[model samples]
Target: MPKEQLREAAEGLARQLERQHGVRSSWEGDCVRIKGAGVDGELSFAGGVVDVSVRLGLLASPFKGMLQAEVQRYLDEHVS
Candidate 1:
């Protein structure tokens, strides 16, 4: 994806996270930093590649697979 499209996708994902998971996110330079009761992460886009790094607290660990799937689904929907 181009930088603009990546940024748009990032913003949309941020909104979805906040609305559905109560997480908050903000742009930190070229990435989106996300935080919530049991999650902390950054979503970065560069060289037409998108990367997501997440740290799930103990309370959130059990949902890891689900979270990954959701992120993948969201990216698939928007990045193409």
Candidate 2:
């Protein structure tokens, strides 16, 4: 995808996260901080580059890798 298209898509996903999952996000540089999340995920968007990182606290280490997968599932379903 073109840079602008990717950015637009990233923005859409961010909005979807908020509207559909009740997740809050804070943008810093190209990264976002998702809060009130069982497994908080950081999504970076810049120049058509989007990256995902799901942070499960030390207490929930087992779920660290699951954040992105779960979010992808939600996006696929567009659950609203």
Each prediction's whole-model lDDT (CA): 0.93, 0.64
Best by lDDT: 1
Question: Per-residue lDDT tens digits of candidate 1, residues 21-56?
Answer: 999998987899999989999999977789999999
Report residue 33 deviation for candidate 2 (angstroms): 2.4
TM-score of each: 0.95, 0.57
Question: Tens digits of per-residue lDDT for model 2 on 1-80?
Answer: 56555545556777776886677877786676776556477777565555677666676677555556766774455322
In candidate 1, the residue pairs with backbone N, CA or C atoms under 3 Å apart (3 or more residues apart, or in different chains) clash, namely none
lDDT of 1: 0.93
Model 1 off-target regions past 4 Å?
A: none
> What's the true lDDT of residue 77 in model 2?
55
Top TM-score hit: 1
Q: Which ten residues in a row have the lowest lDDT in candidate 2?
A: 71-80
